[model samples]
Structure formats: structure tokens, C-alpha cells
Target: MENKTPIIALVDDDKVFQLTASRTIKAAQLTDKILQFENGEDALVFLKNHASDSETLPDYIFLDINMPYVDGWMFLEDYSLFKTKLSKPIEIYMVSSSIDPRDVDRARNNENVRQYIIKPVTREKFIELLGKAAA
Candidate 1:
């Protein structure tokens, strides 16, 4: 990935959302390495390995709340365990198709999560996330 473009880790169980988000992000030209995953479990595995590698980890992660097996919330709980591995707090954004107030409320309280945004992510929001990651 280029140093100029931000890297984003996109975790969602839905294949459609993952593909759409990845396409939209690249279409906006806001990121270079926009990793896609079908579940939070695999995403977490990748995150762990990436953090251990010498290379810099992803600057941002877009997490989906509703998924089979290890959901986004569970991932967050586990992510906290690896908090010490990071030099700074990794920017995480909750992206979901559901509009549940409780889900939004829960995500807001998580210090690692920066935003709780509804899916069908647009160029503007994607760009905004890139700015946050860069900051």
C-alpha cells in the first residue's frame, strides 16, 4: 500500500456489503489496502498477525455488528486485550445495516470505536473515515 493512501480493514459477514464497501472505497480513491472479511473471527486473526508484523497495521477498521460466530461486539471485547500492542488506539468504525438505537449506544461507549455509521457507505463518509485514520 502507498503511504499517501490510508488503509482500512472492512469486517462484515455479508458478502454483498463487503464487496460494495470495498468497491466504493476504491472508487473514491480514499484508500489503497481496504481489507475485506466475511466474519469478525477471521478479521481478528488478521489483525493479530498484522499487529505482530514489522509493517504498520491498518489505520482504520470498519466493523459490522451483525454477523455469524464472532460478531463485531465480540471482536471489540477481544480487541481491547490487544490494546497494548498498538502504539496508538486503532480507529474503528461500526458499519451496519441495522438502525437499532441500542447498537448505536453500545458502540458509542467503546473507546476504540470512532463512529457508528449505517451501511451503503458513501464516498463522503468513506473520505471522512480516511481523514480520521490519517489524523
Candidate 2:
């Protein structure tokens, strides 16, 4: 049998965070395919375009709350509308720097969001999240 690696998407406006997180994810060796999006709008477009292509869709998404074009909340709102059309289930984790209770509550309440993870996720956390997704 061939081994299928999980694809991960990092949707955030922070270039530094994207670079650091990508490095951490790479070090974990959970997957080699990492997609980067500067905002939720681009990520949403990608998801929509690949809705029927499981091979091209990401298995996991790390979404940031604040962004220029489209925020995480907005992305989730749009995503919920067409989630059922996706060929494969995508686990979305709301990774934000915001510590506001409202933000946490909102993310936790979203059915599409797998979990709300705080920003600057450690290498161990990346492994844990990716391992869970891979499994």
C-alpha cells in the first residue's frame, strides 16, 4: 500500500508566523505538502476550487482570526455553506493571537472548527495536531 501524506494549509497574514510555523511543521515530518495563504479569501478560493478534488484539497487548515481581505470568522461562515460539497473532510483549527473570550467562544461554537489553538504553537503542538489529523 502507498502511504498517503496529509496536506496542511496555513492561513494567516503574518509572514513571520507563517515562516516559523511552516518550519515547525516541516521539522515534525508529518507532511511535506504545506500550502500558505496570506488571507482567508485566498484560502477560501482554493478550497472552493478544489472542492471536488480530494487530492488537491488540504487535510488540515490553521486559520488566523484577523486578516486583511477575509478574517477567520468570515472564512468559517463561507466554509460552512459549502463544506458538504467537499470530497474529503478538512479539519480546521482556529489559530489566533487573540485571547478574547468572545473569539474563543465563537470558534468553539463553530461546527466546522475542530479546535481553537492559541498563536505561536510549539513544535510539539504541531506534531500533536498533525498526528491527530494523520491518524
Q: Judged by TM-score, which candidate is best?
A: 2
**lDDT (tens digit, per residue) of candidate 1 on 1-135:** 355656678888888887878888888888668778888899888878777653456668899998999999999999999867865456889999889999999999988799999988888888787866666
What is the alpha-carbon lDDT of model 1 when measured against the actual structure?
0.82
- Which 10 consecutive positions of candidate 2 have the poorest summed lDDT? 126-135
Where's the lowest-lDDT run of ten residues in candidate 1?
50-59
Candidate 1 vs. true structure, TM-score: 0.89
Cα lDDT for residue 42, model 2?
98
How accurate locally, in lDDT, is each candidate? 0.82, 0.92
Question: For every candidate structure, what is the RMSD over all alpha carbons to the true structure, in angstroms?
Answer: 2.3, 1.2
TM-score of each: 0.89, 0.95
| Off by more than 4 A, model 2 | 1-3
